[model samples]
Each structure stands twice: as C-alpha cells, then as structure tokens.
Target: MDKIRNFCIIAHIDHGKSTLADRLLEHTQTVADRDMQDQLLDSMDLERERGITIKSHAIQMNYRNGGDEYVLNLIDTPGHVDFSYEVSRSIAACEGALLIVDASQGIEAQTISNLYLAMENDLTIIPVLNKIDLPGASPEEVSDEIVDLLGVERDEIIRASGKTGQGVDDILDAIVKRIPAPKGDPEAPLQAMIFDSQYNPFRGVEVIFRVFNGTFKKGDAVKFVNTGRTYNADEIGILKLEQEPQKEIAAGNVGYLISGIKNAREVKVGDTITHVERPCEAVTGFEDVKPMVFAGIYPVDTTEYEELRASMEKLQLNDASLVWEPETSAALGFGFRCGFLGMLHLEIIQERLEREFDMTVITTVPSVQYKAVMTDESIKWVNAPSEMPEPNKCSHIEEPYIKAQIISKSDYIGPIISLCMDKRGILKNQVYLTTDRVELTFDLPLAEIVFDFFDKLKTISRGYASLDYELTGFRQSNMVKLDMMLNGEKVDALSAIVHRDKAYEWGKRLCEKLKELLPRQMFEIAVQASIGTKIIARETVKAMRKNVLAKCYGGDISRKRKLLEKQKKGKKRMRQVGNVEIPQEAFMAVLKLD
Candidate 1:
C-alpha cells in the first residue's frame, strides 16, 4: 500500500491535460514509444477529433528508480461540464488529482469549477503549470493567479511542458512524495467502489474498481451493495494498454472485475462490490446523476423501433447517466423521450445511434424541465412543451435557471453582456483575470442557453470566450410556449419556450425562416406562429401554379384564356382544403436561427 499512488489529471478543455498524461505515460515507460499514441487516454476517435475528453479512462503503470519500485494508477477525465459526472467518478477512484492549468490561458470557467469539485472530494491536489514551451507562455502571471485562487506557494507549483517532456521527472517525484499512499486493511472483509463499467460482447460486464479493503480472487462471488445482487467473478485483471489477468487483486489496488453477468442493469457505477460470503458495509456513495436536458428521439423509419430500443440499451450499458423511456408523438410516430446531462451529451448519443447502430433518427428541439404552479394550488414538472399545462390551468410557470461563468477578453465584455442580457441573463459579478482578459458571471435561464448560446457566445467573443454552467434552481417567470402552424396544422416539433415580451419578434422571425425553408406547394400554404388563441405572425406561401397556356395552339387565344381562368379557380379551391407536406428540415428550421 505504501508503494501505490492513485491519481487523476483534471483541467479545462484544450489546457493540455491529455498531453500531460501522454508525457507521463512515456516518462514512466508505461507504454513503449512505438506503441504510444498522442493523447492516448482519449480512446475514442470523436474525442480526438473534438480535442476534448468525453469519457474517463484509467491505466496502471509500473515505475522503478534506483532501488525503489512504485505502482501508479492514473485516470484521465473529461474536462467539459457536460461530463462532470464522469469527472466525479474518476476523482472518487483516486487519492489525489493533478490540476493542470495552461500557462497562456491560465484559469478558465471550467478550471474553477473543477477546482471546487476536487476540494469537495477531499483529494490532494497537485497544481501543475503546463505548456511552458509556448511562445506567449507566462509562468509568473499564471502562477500568481493560481496562488491567489488556490492559496498555494509559488515554489510549491510545478512548471512543466507536456509537449517537450520537461519537468516530467519532477512531476513523477511529486506524485510519490506529495500524494499519500492508499490506506486500507487487507484483512478486512471485501470492499470496493465501482468507478466505471463497460459491456463486453465476449466477457459480459467488465467493471473498473478500487479495492478499499480485503482481497479479491478470480473465482470470488461478489455482491453489489446497491442492487443486492451476486455474481461469480469469471476473471480479475489490471489495465495497462490492455487487460492482464492476475491471481489476486490486493487491498488498496485498482483493477477490473469481469462480473460474469450478461445484463448491464445488474451492476452500476458508484455501487460497492463485496464478497458475498463475508460482505462488509457499503461505503458512503456518490449522489445520483440527474439529467439536465431532455429531447425526443424518433426513428426516421418507425418500423425500426425495436432496433432503436436495443441500440439504446447497449449504449446505456456504458453510459449509465442516460435515461429514456418509450414515448409516442402525434407527428413523430413512435419514439423515446431521452434525458441527458446536457446538450453535448444529447448530441453525442444521437450521433452514435445513427453511426454505430445504423438507424436514422429525428431529434426534436431540446428542452428543460419547468415547474408549473397550477390554479388548484398544485405543482407539476414538465419536460416538454406538450406536457405543459394549459395557461388557464396554471397560476404561474417557473423555468430552470443556471449559473454561467464566462472568460473572455475585456474588449468583448460589452457585447458579451449584451448577449447575456438578451437571453434574460442577470449579471451577478465580473472580475479581471488579466489586463486584457476578464471573467463574467451571470444567472441565466437554462432554456436560453440549451439551444445556441455556446455557439453565439463564441461568435460574439470572436472565438475567444469559454463557458461553464450549472443548473441553479427554478425561478418564476412569464413564459409562453410558442407554436408554429403550417396549413392550419400544428407542427409539435417546432414549439419553443420564450418570454412573452419576445413572443412577437420570435414568432415573426420563426415564420420568416420557415417560409424560406419550406418547399413551395401545389396550393397556398400559411405559416403562422401563435400563442394559445393569438396569432403573432403569419407568412403566406403562394400556390405553385402550372401554366395552363403552355400547350395552346396559335389560333383560338380566347380558349387559352378560359383555360387559365379555370386553372386559377381550381387552385383557389384546392388552397382551402389541401394539406401541405412540410419537410423534416422545415421543422428543424428554428435550430438554425442562432
């Protein structure tokens, strides 16, 4: 136990956490140079392409110096706010965390949030200043900021360049010296924390856990504390680049357990695994992850409903945070209403379903849960506009709000604040990080930012602004559900939540955008936006009339004129009763308004 060190690397996205992990992986010779890949901890291609970590990955390493040998268990976690749950689970598995801050960008919105998270977990945090090799690298300036933020001495902070392998040895030494060894009693009954899991087609459910006490052998029958279920361990092993089987995983060690259970629901992250014969009490566990964003996912072809369900179940095996249920939409055929941690999480699942499962899906506009106070003194929580109670039936509606922190240049503060104000954001505070860069904090509505806030914030700040947000609570507001109607038919997918004051402008703009996107029809199509009984804006799509005079002969001009008049009359009659076929893209036009 004294020779083991379990730790994780935490940082803001693009702040070089993965790069630092790469340098450390090579420094310890965990994997050889030929086999090593850049940002090796990011196992998914999507993660590398997006330049961010979406999932947490773990690896065990063996290091030797002089006469001392050490076991280091390193976990790399996603830095984005959407994956905060993953970060928490990663932190829980480790005794310490390495806080990596970029020398150029310094601390960011996510940096502060991650700092608080580390503090909450009571883990030893080693502050490391990374990317000293960059041209604009300012170690002194960023060092001062870290000192101010973390109250750590300048000398205590280690300076390293992940790209050049500088200070790699010093960091490894600090881990052995600073991070205390994992503490547990090998004689105690079995106890372990399941930090991560995966569904293996060949091996059943493989779970990554840290042994808190006792010993686990290959054939031990372990019981899950949360579910009260027992499974015979088919195999036990440790992960480096791949699984290496072991005779036993001792106390205070991190490894994998091949729980020979085909069903994913039998095990879960944050659940405790104990020996069935001599089980110990479960440790205080993590809080349940509540999804903040909701969306309706319907199959492009409804006949593939069962296939979609199976695909979702497979995905849920790995992503326990995902929650979904069978739902039927009047317009979208059969589908499921899925909940996600945030917008990024929702997008990732949608993309993976389409690409990995070979199923085409139509996702509705994302929504936030709103609390409604009914006229009968009752309260209800709604996730979709269709679930909202009638305006007359409610005394008031309360929408979810978020505490958003932004970091950007001072020159762009004016426009950034203006954008926030437009989104019904209340400025809470602002502080100068540097002479040029500033941090702005606001309390904004969750619905406001769920759609296009991040993209718009980037545009407003000229791609220099970064954002972090968390749901604060619900606040009473004058909210309305704006609906769009095409040819007197309500398109449920085009509904949105908006403040009443912006209803006219929002309605007018949506109608205009829809008019440009919807194809011309055989008859006139009326695109109208409304709130309850009031029509706020309307756009008329003229009938696409066929020329009645195209086949007319040179003679009998009067006959051709009569044919044109008849055609006009027929078009006018058809315009009154014919249905307009709006394409799928038209229903998604509101998403482009950003």
Candidate 2:
C-alpha cells in the first residue's frame, strides 16, 4: 500500500483553515490549469456567504518529497462550536490532525476544545500557526502559547501564512514527518465511519466516509450497522480536491458512495458502514447529539408549508445534526420546530432554507433549554416558547448556563466586564495577555448571552472583542415564565421564562419593540406584557386611517379601493386581539434591542 496520511485541519473561527486548504491544493498542483475557484473546499454558496465551513470536505493530493510520491487525504472541518459534534466525527475519521492556530490571536476557546478532541482521539497532531503575514502577525507569541497551553514542544510549531503561501511548503513537510500514516487492516472486514453525508437528486443519498478497515470495490453490498439497512454500492469516488472525481477509493482514503439509497434518514453520521456478508462490529465513541437551541421555523406564506417541510426534509437528509419536527402556531400556520447546535447554526439554516429553497420563513424567537420542576413532582425539559409552563404552575425552574471566554484589548476590559455583569454573568477567572489584551472567563446563563451579547460586545469594543462559549450546565435559580398578551388574550408563541429581576425590563422592551415594528393596521393594536395573570406594560399602535387617501387624487379610485381592500384583507389575515392586527414583524421585533 502507498504511504497515505489522513489528517484533518482544525481551527477556530476565521483562523484560515479553508484558506490553508486552498493553498495546499495549489501547492500540490491539485488544481487544474483552467480551474480557478477560490476556497475550493467551500463548495456551497451558503458556506461562502457565511464565511464558515458548514460542511466537512475531504480532498486527496499527491505530494513528491525526495523523489518519493505520497498521498495525502486532507479533511477540512467546521470551526464553529455549533458543528463541534460534526468536527469530532470528522476528526475520528482521520489518523491525524493539523491544529491550526491564528498567529496573532493565539489560541481561542474553540481552538482549545478542538485540540482536546484531537488529543482524546489519540490522533497525531501537527501544530501549524497560520496567517503569519498579517500586520499583527506574532508567530513567536503564538508558538510559545501553543507550547505553554497545548504542551507542544517549542520546535514543533509550523509557521505559515496561508494568505500569501509563505512557508506553506514547510507546513507540508512537517505534515509528512509529524502526522503518521493511516494504519488499518485492508484485508479485514469492511468498516467505515459515516462522517458526513448529503442528498443529490441524481445520485440519491451521497454517503461520505473514511474506510477504517478492509475495503470493497464497486458493486459491494454493504450494511449500515446502526440502521441495519443494506445497499449495493453502485459506484465509489474520491474527491481530487479539484472539480473532477476519481474512479476508485480504498482504505485510508476519504470518498463518497452512491448506493442508490434515496432515503437520507437511513444514512446517518456516526453510522458504521460494513460489508453485509461479513459485517464488523460497530465502532465506539459515537454519542447522541442533542441540539441545544431551538426556534419555530414557519413559512412566510401559509400555503408553502408543504414546500418548507420538503425543504427541511431534504436538508436533514445530508445534515444529520439538524433536527426538525412538526409544529403549529396560530400566527404562523404549520411549520417545524427546528433544533440547532447553536445560534450560528440556527441562522445558517434559516438563511439556507430561504435562499436555497426559495421559500420565505417566519422564524420565532430562539429559545434556550429550560428545566421545569412541576407541582406534581415531575421533571421535564422545555425548549419551545409555547411549552413553558405558567409561573404559578411550576414549583421551581432552572435555566441552562454556559462558560464563556471573552478576549479583548485591556482598554475595553471594563466595558466587557460591565456588559457581562449586566447580563448576570459571574466571573470565573481572568488572565492578561501581553500588556493591552485580557481574557475574561465567566459562568453565565445561556439565556442571557444568547440574544445580543456578541453584538453589544462589538459595539462597546469597536469590534476588537472576540468571544467563545461552551454550554456549562444548569443551575437552580428563581425564574419566572413571562407571557405576552395582545389585548388581554395570551399569545402562546410570545411567552418566555426569564429571571424575576429582569422580567419587567425584558417585558417592557419586548412590548415596545413589537409596537414599533408592527405597522399600523385598520384598527388600534395593544401590545401588552404579562406575568401570570397580571399585565405589567402595554403599548398602543394607532389604526392606519389615511393610507390610501393619496390614491384618490390620481383618478385611480378602483385601484385605490382595490389596494385598500387588499390592505384590509391582509389585516384580516393577522392575529386580531380586541382591535389590533398583530403583524409578523411584530413577532420578529422582539429579537432586536432598543
């Protein structure tokens, strides 16, 4: 067998992992003479738009060193914490990993988490300090930090500017020497881990995996160990890291399979692929992925509910991490309660659902996990806005908490700490970096920071702040489940459980924002805030009286009357409480801060 090296590149957000991959492909002459697409691993438009690696991509290249040819199977993993589970799965498929750290920014929280994951997997780690050509390039400091924090030897850090292609060859050389070749029995029973998958209308379910042991050629019958579903592999191909596909792939290689399996639900990530006749035991280390954040996703037009469902189903086929179930709302009609890894993942999914599927979505307010203790002595987990029990119905409640790390310039330390404190953040530790930058660690409730913490941090620090957080756990605390009422009628979709101290402030803010965003209708609208049965605050939206008064002067009275009728019909479609027509924008207004 050829000397093959299977390794994944891990990094924090904006650490140049994809850029470095492009550089590697260019240096290896993997790109064809006429092919010219930047960030080739970012195949999807959504991936490029977000500037995040949503999908983990694998590519193969031939490297010649000392007149010896070696094959490199390089996998690029997502840098965001939302896709951390996917990152772990991708790492498990590789024999080694390239821990790419930003030269100036040093190691981030996600970077550390990814490093710990690689260590746990026992993968050979090749430390690479990327972006060495930037104005603030500090390879020496980053190198020292790597040695100090990651326990890597000082001499092991590979310095490279993925942006300028400087010192890239050195990185490649280190990869060849530091990362070990994949070691598995090619003759053993066929076994592979399904790290990622997708659905193509022409090819059906495209299952991408790294063969751990044994391999089979085309026409091999394989069984998914977890699902017990069998399929005949009609074709197998490896991504050349360019635009074309290779004919065959083997053990220690990353590739995709066309098994004619149309159902994407059957082919799940972490599922073991094995030969049907002689299947190997399922691989260990796979864990059930639980989505930490959820939002009610609905079609902007109620008629497109089926289309939205189809789109979500299609998306879920390849993205096993995405969770969705049927959900309904009086305001949004029928939709899905989509669960995501985190806020970023939720945004990406919503954006893709609209852009890729050409369907407008009405997303409900994002909700974090809540632990409810019932008066009947029952424990339950609640995530939906409509599911939060009334304050009087609960004996006790707890909100999910997270451990957050904020790195900022020393000058902005006061503002950052103040912002965190206002959100009920408790400082766990603090460290100074150099003389001007400081890193503050806090144990804060996820509910507090989920809304606009990052935005506020940017505003306060003038975009000099970088933050990272991980879900710590839950803490028992006094909390109240607050509800929104429109003209004394409770809106289940607008309810939330907040800390008792901040309830009035949040309620007033939400009601005022909703009134501002909700356009005036044919009748007066009242936005009310409620705690249990008592109303705390209210805002009035005056009825639109002269919306079509200008049209009468144009001598298009029929058109004017039609427009008014359409407006009246649109007003009728809205949720009416007393005299108010609550627009969809009113519901969305709660997301923004005053």
Candidate 3:
C-alpha cells in the first residue's frame, strides 16, 4: 500500500490537463516504444475530436526508480465548467489533485473554481506551473501568484513543461511524497466506491471503482448498497494503461469490474459495492444531477423516433449525467425534451449520439428556468415556451440571471463592453490586468448568455477573450415570453425569453431565419411572432411548384403516380396549416440563427 498513489489532474479548459497525462504516461514508461499514441487517456473518438475530456478515465502505471517500484493510479478529469460535477466525483476518488496552471496565463476563473473544489474535498493539492516552454511563459511570476492567491508556500510550486518533459521527474517525486496511500481494512468486507462506469456490449456494465476495504475478485457476488441489486462479477481486471488487462485487483487499487448486470442505473457513481455476504453502507454524494438547460431533441425523420429512443437509452446507460423524458410537441410530432448541464455539454452529447448511434436529430432552442406567477397566486417553473402561462393568466414572471467574469485584451475592451451592454448586461466591475489586458464582471440575464454569447465574445475579441459565469439566482426584471405560431397553432418548442424592448427585433430576426430554412410547401406558410396577445412580426412562405413533370420518362407513370400518392400521403401526414406539409426542418430552423 505504501507504494500506491491515487491522484487526478485538474486544470482550466485547454490548459493541457490531457496533454500532461500523456506526457506522464510516456515519462513513466507505461506505454511501450511501439504503442505510443497522443493523449492516451482520451480513448474515446468524441473526446479526441472535441479536444476535451468528456469522461473521467483511470489508468495504472508502474514507475521504477533506484530499484523501487511505485504504482501510480492516474485519473484524467474533464476541464470544462459544465462537467464540474463529474470532476468533483473524480476528485473524491483520489487522495490528491495536481493543480496544473498555465505559466503563461496566470490563474483564470475556472482554475480558481476547480482549486476551491479540490480544497473543499480535503485533497492535498500539488500546484504545478505548466506550459513553461511557451514564448510568454512566466513560471516564476505564476509561482508567486500561487503563493499569494492559494496561500501556499512558494517552494511548493513545481515548474514543468509538460510538452518538453522538463521537470516532470520533480512533479512525480512530489506526488509520491505528498499523496497518501490508501488506508482501509483489507481484511474486512469487500467494499468499493463506483466513481465512474462504462457500458461494453461484451461486458455489459463495466464499473470502475477504488477498493476501500477488502479484496474483490472474479465470480464474487457483490450488491450495490444504494440499489440493493446483486451481480456476479464475471471478470475483474486491472488497468495497466495498455490494451491488455491484468488479473486480481486488490484493495487500495483502481480498476474495472465486469458484472452481468445490464441495467446501468443500478450501479451508480458514489455507490458502494460490498460482498453480498457482508453488506456495507453506501458512500455519500450519489445525488442525481439536475439539468439546468432544457431543449427539444427530435429525429430528423419522425419514423426514427423509436430508434432514437433506444440509442439514447444505451448512451444514457454509460452517461448517467444526461437526463431525458418523452415529450410531444404539436409542431414536432413526437420527441424528447432533454436536459443538459450547459450548452457545451449539450453539443457534446448531441455529437456523440449522432456519431455513435447514426441518427440525425433536430434540436430546439435551449432555455433556462423561468418563475411564473399565475392569476390564482400559484407559482410554477417554466422550461418551455409552450408551458408559459397565458398572458392574461400570468401576474409576474422572472428569469434566471448569471454573474459573468470576462478576461480579454485591452484593445477589444470597447467591443466586449458594447456586446455586453447590447445583451442587457449590467457592468458590476472592471480591472486592468496589465497595459493590454482587462478583466470585467457583469450581471447578465442567463437567457442572453446561453446562446452564441461565447461565440460573439470570441469574434469581438478576435478570439482572445476568456469568459466564465455562474448562476446568480433569478431576478425581477422587465421580461416577456415570446411565442412562435405556425399558421394559427402555437409551437411550444419555439418560445423564448426576451426583454420587453428587444422582443420586436428578436421576433423579426427569428421570422426571417425560419423563412429561409423551412422547405417550400404546397400552401402558404405563416410565421408569426407574438408576445402574449400582441403579434410583432409575420412572414408567408408561398406554395411550392411540383417538379415531377420534368422527370417523368420510360413509361414511369406508375412511378409518377406513386410520387403523387406519396406527396398526397405526406400532405395528409403533415399538420394542416391552411394547406401545407411543414417539414421537420421548418421546426428545426427556429432553433438556430442563419
């Protein structure tokens, strides 16, 4: 046990957390000469493509120095703020965290946030200043800032260029000295914390956990403490950070367990697994994560709804963070309104679902929570535009707001400030980092920042801006819920929360975008935007001309007749708005800007 060390590396997004993991694996000779691959811990194709760690990965490494062998249990954690909850769970499984800070860029907002979480977990932190090989590297200055900001001893900062393998030895040495080995009763009942899990077709549910008490082996009957579900471990293997697996993972080790259990919900994160003969209490922090953003997710083809549902279920089995419920929208025949941690998380899940399941999806406009006061003095939470109380029935409405902190270059400050002001942002404070950089904080509506705000900020700052935000509770303000009506019926998926003054402008923009993306129909399509009882803008899509006449040949009147019959059937399938088949594309068009 004295030779074992369990730790995770935490850093801001794009701060080289994954890169550092790769370097460490190489430095420790964990991977053979021919088995070299970049970002080894990032095994998933989606993770590599997005250049982000979507899931936490654990791998074991054997490092030898002076004829002494040390087993390093390295866990790679997601750096994005949206997946902070997962990061915390990963931290809880480890005894320490390597706080990697970019030497060129001092501690950013996310760096501070992750650091605070690690501190709260009572994990020993080893501050490492990374990226020292960059041209703007300032390890010494960052070291000083670490001492002042984190209240750590200046000598505690380890400087290393994860890219060039400089000072990596010292970092590993520090980890060996600082991180404590696992302390548990190895002779007691078998118990482990399921920190993470994965689903394999061949293995069913592959649970990755750290044994805290007794040893577990293949064919052991274990019961999940929370769910009380029992499973016979068919296979138990140790991860060597390689393709091949090792046998017999004992207490004080991190590895995988292949149980015959097919249900993913039964084996949850933070749940304790104990030998059925000797039960144990479950670990804390297994609460289900509540999603903050909700959006309608529909298949491109209505016929694929069942297939999409099955695919989502399989995906959810591995990723318990994703929440979904069956929902039906009048405009979008049948679909699921899914909830996510944030925009990036939503995008990642969408991309993964499409890539892994081979399904085309149309998503609706994302929305934040809204507090509505009904005529009878009843308060309710509104997540969809269709769910908004009737105008006359609503007495008051409030939307969620956020406190945002933005860091950017000085020359772009004017444009950043202008953008913020245009989004109904209230400036709270601003400070100059240097002659050419500034940090600004503002109180902005959550709805405003939820969509394309980060993209706009990057464009305005020439891709030099860094922004971070946290929910600052709902506030009473002048706001209106705008609804989009196709023909005469309302589309709940097309609703939005906008300031009273900007409702007309938003409505006009949405109407035009929808007009361009919606396919031509047999009858005029009406796109109307309304605020309560008032209509702000409207557009009409003229009838489309059938092009079948030009293609009829080879005595294919049967084909032509079939085409006409199919078109008639399509027309019949569509919701009649005057006389038109409003394609699913039309509903999807409202979700995005042109």
What's the TM-score of every candidate structure?
Answer: 0.95, 0.91, 0.89
What lDDT tens digits, residue by residue, belong to model 1 across residues 479-524?
9999888877888877877889988998999999888888888878
The 10 consecutive residues of candidate 3 with the worst lDDT sum are 572-581
Measured on C-alpha atoms, candidate 1 has an lDDT of: 0.88
Task: List the candidate 1 regions with Cα displacement exceeding 4 Å.
Answer: 553-581
lDDT of each: 0.88, 0.81, 0.81
Q: Of the candidates numbered 1 and 2, which has the greater lDDT value?
A: 1
Model 3 C-alpha lDDT per residue in residues 152-228, reported as the tens digit of each score: 88888888887898888998899888999878877888889988887777767788889988888778888988888
lDDT by residue for model 2 over 115-171, one digit each (tens)? 888999999888888988889988887787788776878878888888789878987
Backbone clashes, candidate 2: 0
Worst 10 residues of 1 by lDDT: 585-594
Candidate 3 local lDDT, residue 187: 83
Using TM-score as the yardstick, the better of models 2 and 3 is 2
Backbone steric clashes in candidate 1, count: 0
Colliding pairs, model 1: none
